[model samples]
Target: MADGIDQLPVVRTITCSHPSHAGYEKDFSEFWTGAPDSKLTNRGDTKKWNGGFRGRPALADALWPELRNYLIGRKPSIFNNAITALRAFWRFLDGYERYGMEPISQLSDISTSLSILWLNPIDEMWSAHSRQAHEIIGVLVRNARKREKMQSAWAWHPYPRAESTESKELPTEGQIRTAMHLLKQSAYGIYARWKRADAMAAEGKNLLTVSRSRQGERNQKGQLKRAFDFELTEADAHATYRAFIASSGNPLPSMADLFVALGLNGKDYPPWWPTYSQDHPQAGQVVR
Candidate 1:
């Protein structure tokens, strides 16, 4: 029986009369041939694949567990594609019954079971991918029922949203200061490196001859030089500060002079009021 099964020709095509069903047929054929332990043999071959199960019953029994095992440490995109292929297989089975073949059990049962497996406590990190897969499967099942002219038992159930694991607390003032200091230091270092490079270039020497750490400091310096070809003006800083104040919903105390210069009454005025003055100091004056 095993040898006979191994000699069975691989499924190369899935036929359906519906024009819209062509893509699903192709996907199913590809999956059937490619899936591990699929008992169907390749053309002119008699060996069974090592990884996939034999037929629909074997697939139905082992698909989810095998899929979960395949997805271990895989990327989210790969997981999405795997689920898509599985859903296509289910769609093929549902459509095949239109030609007088026996109907398989509703795939929703398998989807629900897989969803529970995805939510297993030991592998909590895959919750997002699992939710996405569940939603995709739900959509596929709904579409398959509509195409087959059958009533759908697959009820819509919301997948639980994954909570963010990142820290939500705002940075402390000290932390902010430290970040600013680091930024200044980085800027200074980049500037010094560029100056050295410029001097080397002026002396008819290759800029690459300058000392650069393995962290791609040379590439970084080149990028920085190209980026800051033009100097940032005082107006830029003023605009940035104003934008920050607006976004932060904080009153701009230091910018009161800027408001007076712009002719807006700075005293007891709402933060958004525009001020203009003929002698108004450049927007950079207050910022400086």
Candidate 2:
């Protein structure tokens, strides 16, 4: 009887029959096997890899920690691969009715694991890999819970990195005056060029509309001339404005702000001005 039992074929049981189960099985199998031939040595190591989760409890208790350990000090590519595999496994488990709802303890466990990874020490000069790891963990954990729950958990924190120091020396009166003068000149130049461009755009639109409406012999010959005029004027206006902006070397306000600075009334502005003013109530208002 023992010999007969040993000879019997092994059977596998699948509790969930959802179509996604097949995809889950495939992802889990690939994660278990790992990519040994890949250039990354850590990725090729199968011993450290956790054969995918058997259930929700296993996923939270075993697989999460395994992934956190595997990703430590690893290259971004390998870290991303592990994260992707874990996401697929989690998604599959979440879809399956039997293990869909995650318990609070499991969520807490995963959050703690992420916090530990995030707080891991690194060199004084922060590395790109460390930043990437922090971002990935934050995104994954945030997505795992609802917005309200995430706010309540309060486990997540800003990335662990050095803050830049503020300059201690203040500008002298002469330096401040010189800077202000340069900024004013640049702003005035930009405003003038913007107004020219705005006028040209309005004229071009009118010319184009007129050219399009002329369908009779009385206006046929002048239609092409009008269209060419519109295009040339529009092109020149845009080019001049762009060149002025590029050369200004200073931050400038929006066209509407420039219009107001030039003392133009909002009521006499283009048709789009009303809509824009409604959307951005502060646009035409004077800024102090």
The number of the candidate with the highest lDDT is: 1
Model 1 scores a TM of 0.27
lDDT of 1 at 199: 31
Which regions of candidate 2 fall more than 4 Å away from where they truly are?
Answer: 1-105, 111-118, 121-129, 147-151, 162-288
- Candidates' lDDT values, in order? 0.39, 0.36
lDDT of 1 by residue, 161-249 (tens): 66777887988999987876775465445444333322332333111122312222223323221222234333333343343333333
lDDT of 2 by residue, 110-163 (tens): 532233322431221111234554546555554454422432212344465676
Count of clashes in candidate 1: 11
**Candidate 2: RMSD to truth:** 21.1
lDDT of 2 at 275: 19
lDDT of 1 at 58: 39
Candidate 2, which ten residues in sequence have the lowest lDDT sum?
Answer: 1-10
Q: TM-score for every candidate vs. truth?
A: 0.27, 0.23
Give me the runs in candidate 1 sitting further than 4 Å from their true place: 1-7, 12-27, 30-34, 37-54, 57-118, 121-131, 165-288
